[model samples]
Target: MADIEVFVFAVEAELEAMDRERVGVHRRGRKPDLALRRRLVGLVWTLTFGGMQWRVAGWLSGIPFTTLHSAFARWARLGLWRRLGQRLALDWRLACGDEVLPSAVVVDSRSLRSAPSAWARGIDGGKLIKGVKALAVCDKHGSLLDLELYPANTDDRAGALPLLSRLAALGFQGDLLGDSGFKGAPFATAALAHDIHVSVSPGGTRDGCFLPSGIRWVVERLFAWLSRYRRLNIVYDRAPDLFAAHIWIAMISIISRRLVAQTHT
Candidate 1:
């Protein structure tokens, strides 16, 4: 692993960028008491590696457990996760080149089992299995170009449009390919409006199609990278926003690794 200080500096830069975009402010909030941030990063590293509890994190960082817990909650509530996700995705595009522009791009979704605390029961829906589905778009190098997350029961197809829209916002205009689940015309028409061609696998025909398998696998590979962190493997935080922060933190770590690789190359 790289030096923690280098990781901290990269995170601090990413955080500042996120704060500016999400909160309309770029203030560092009293220098974050570098000592505190250092300890916080340590805790994150522990939880990320499937270590002990917050108390253990505190003991390791030499800070009170409650303070660490409180800070984690506060940052999560502030949409740090989404910001981190955006930052990592953007960084990937800048470092690896955007495949969605003038080339074929892959779109897909993945289902993850939910934590007990994350379960949601509806009045008429009954107690259904709780989980989340994430939609991701990526280039050939496993670099995230776009992504979105929603309740496990949410239609995967429904999430596709938002991810597509995100790509558009980032100036991606090209061909998109997906499985048959995205058979509806809405997404096709949406892409068409942007001059993007749509290719969907046909039903009952598993043999042949214009497969963008190689490009599409990049997003799945990114998910694999995310699962390397335990905090992201499960929705331990009751609040969605907090769960998102951990996700972003994990992404930042992956992007940092990629950045290092690029510099050496």
Candidate 2:
């Protein structure tokens, strides 16, 4: 069987369950094509693992580029990738003997240069890059919990509030650690209202030399993990939402591998 077929079979039950829930009473038109679904799922793996462009993946996978692109966008709109990431995160925590819900999380952002034609680009004064910024929140173990993308010139505090607010709505209550960019009375007050304590560490400098701090390093490492996926190393998608979906897909792949490894060991 093809690698995609094997993966689909492995997660067959989970996919079926999600399909049932997402499709709901609004069902119409013909039922989804299973063969096409397998191919699309395989294409996603190819994109995440090989960092192949859509056209390259289509040619390699023997699926039409237009079909693959349409399926991916439909799934992204249905929030399938985000749900998969969340489920895998819980599974990883369980495999590691930790609580499903994390007690604390680290937050950080990375600025990446966008394609010249990409929309919504901005300049990050700190990084000195003309592109966009990705703000992410990860648990203590570096599993991504949530992420948001905005123009690079957007203030760190401004970008962080929405993510923190989403976490709060999801019933998250814990301490949040971040770099100096997150320091401010306004941000702290906002976080406090969500029952999350906010702490900003001093710059990682000793005598003007750079060094890594302990707590905040987790989120930085999370960004490093994401960079391994070539597609995510830079912003190529014109739609910010599509870019965010790619982020979730990358995390889903990482966490799923770790979970499988833990089970065997």
Candidate 3:
């Protein structure tokens, strides 16, 4: 794992660039006694490596449980995790001599079983799991670009529309490689509007193993990487936004580590 300080620094830089007001820094108050750096470092550590409860995390970090929870909630609500992940991914790509913007993206989804108390969940008939579906888009090198969480009942094409819309909204004009579930005229037509060509991978063999497909594997690798984070291996968050934030946080950690390694080399 990379040092927590690197993740904290990258996030602070992003927050400053995106305007600190979003985190309520400009609000009229006595101001927090704890430094934002320490709080953020603790928060990232909890999200990335600590699977314990927020209270336990706070105890370990020497911050009040409520304070840590409230700060995390505020940042999640403000979409800070997602923004920071994007910024770090871009920086890593640039540092590795890749294009600032990807011309191609791979899309995939994973169905994770939810906790008994989780609110937003549905049965994935294909996977036969009662949970939510995590749809993600990644560049050729497996860097996360965007993610969406929806009910498992949602078909791939239906669940994928929002992610596609987001990519288009971000002015992403290129090709998208996906699995057989994303094939069809409707998706193709939708992607055409954004000047994005949708190419679905070939079907698997009768034994249930997919034939080798070069481009589409990157998204699968991303899912594998995300699964390493205990927080992401299962759906524990009550709200979809918070779940998405955790995914972003995990990616932030991954990208920041890559950036740090690149800097050293």
Give candidates' CA RMSD values in order.
4.8, 2.5, 2.1
Residue range 91-157, candidate 2, lDDT tens digits? 7778878988888888888999998757678998867999999999988789898888899999989
| TM-score winner between candidates 1 and 2 | 2
Residue ranges of candidate 2 with Cα displaced over 4 Å: 1-13, 24-29, 206-210
Model 3 spans with C-alpha error above 4 angstroms: 20-26, 29-37
Clashes of 2: 0
User: Local error of candidate 2 at 43, Å?
Assistant: 0.9
Write down the TM-score for model 1. Answer: 0.75
Clashing pairs in 3: none
lDDT of 3 at 15: 62
The per-candidate count of clashes, in order, stands at 3, 0, 0
| Full-model lDDT, candidate 3 | 0.80
- Name the best candidate (by lDDT): 3
TM-score-superior candidate, 2 or 3: 3
After best superposition, candidate 3 residue 124: deviation in angstroms? Answer: 1.5
**lDDT agreement with native, every candidate:** 0.64, 0.79, 0.80
Candidate 2 residue pairs in backbone clash:
none
Candidate 1 segments whose C-alpha is farther than 4 A from its true place: 1-6, 16-31, 76-81, 92-104, 119-130, 193-197, 202-214
| TM match of model 2 to true structure | 0.90
Worst 10 residues of 3 by lDDT: 25-34
Instruction: Provide the TM-score for each candidate, comma-separated.
Output: 0.75, 0.90, 0.91
